[model samples]
Target: MTEQPARWTEATVYPDMWADPDDDPRNSEGPSPDGELGSLQDYLTNYRLTLRMKCEGLDAEQLARRSVPPSTMSLLGLVRHLAEVERHWRTWLTEDEPLPKLYGKRDADFDGAVAEPAVVEASFRDLEREQAATDAALAGYADLGERVGKDGVAIRELLVHRIEEYARHCGHADLLRECVDGRVGQ
Candidate 1:
C-alpha cells in the first residue's frame, strides 16, 4: 500500500486536487435560469452536483472513512444523511401520516454508513431516490409563498433551507474528500 503522508501530500492526481479546472465537472451544465425560482433552482442543482463531484472516484472504504475523531461524518454518511433529509422534508408536504425514518431509530444514517460496496451503493441509491421525490413534491407548488407542512413553511423557505443544507454538507465533503485522498476542487 502507498504510504499515506503524515497528514496528506501537497499534491495528488490534479496537483492538489482530483481534476483540473478545465475538466472539473463542477461546471454548471445549462443556461442559467432567469428569476427568483430559477435562481434558487440553479443554485440547488449546482450544489447537488458539487456534493456528488466531491464523492466521485472514491472507493467504498474511502467514501465511508470517518472525518476526525468523535465525528461519524463521512462522504457516505453525508449521502445517507441527505437522503434522509430529502425524505423527511418531502413527506411533510405529501404524506398524511408520519413515515418511519429509513435508516434507523437513532443516528442510523451515519452510524450505519460502513465500508462496504453494498452500503455505498444503497446509500447513493437512497439519496437519488429521495432527491427525486423531494423535487417532485416541490414541483406541485407554484408559488414560493405557498405554505406547506406542519410549520406552514413557505415553499421558497424550504428551497432555501435545502440549498443551505447542501451547501453546508458540501463543505464538509470537501474536507473529507481531501482527507481521504488529498483530492480537492472548487
Candidate 2:
C-alpha cells in the first residue's frame, strides 16, 4: 500500500480566523442602536468578550507562556492587566472613595501572572468582577459627557479609552495564540 501525506494549509485549522461571517460567533451582529452611550457600550462589550474568547480553551501553562523573550506579555498577563485596568477606571469613577488596586504598584499585574491554576482562575474572576463594577459605575452616570473625578475626565472619554485598550490587547492576543498552538480566532 502507498502512503498518502496529510493535507495541511498553513498555521491554523481554518484558512482564515473568520472564513464565514454567518458562522463566526465573534462577529458582532451589527452595531448597537443609534445612541452614543449605547453604541460605545456595545463596542466596549465586544472587545472585552474578544479578549476573553482569545484565552478560552487554554491551560494555565499555555495562558502564562510569554509571547516572546524580553517581554512578559502572555494571555494570562493580559487578563490580570485588564482586571487592574478595570479596577483603575472604577476607582476613577468613584473619586471620593477610590478602591485599592488588585495588584499593587505599576506593572504588578503582568509581573504576577505566573503559571498556576489558582492564578489563572483568580485572574479570570478578578477580570469579571472588575468589569461588572466598572459597568455599574458607568450605569450611575446619566450623561456620558459629564465630567468625572479630580482629573475632570469625561465619562465618554473613559468608556472610549477602555474600548481602545481592549482592542489593542486583543490584537496582541491574536499573535500570541497563533504562536502558542496555531489555534486562532474566536
- Give the winner by lDDT: 1
lDDT of 2 at 44: 83
Which residue runs does candidate 1 get wrong by more than 4 Å? 1-18, 29-31
Collision pairs in model 1: none
Q: Which candidate should be chosen as best, given TM-score against the real structure?
A: 1
Q: What is the C-alpha lDDT of each candidate?
A: 0.84, 0.80
Q: Number of backbone collisions per candidate, in order?
A: 0, 0
How many residue pairs of model 2 clash at the backbone?
0
Residue 137, model 2: lDDT of: 78
Put down candidate 1 lDDT per residue, 49-102, tens digits, no spaces.
Answer: 889988888899999999665899999999999999998887667436766798
TM-score, each model?
A: 0.87, 0.85
Worst 10 residues of 1 by lDDT: 4-13
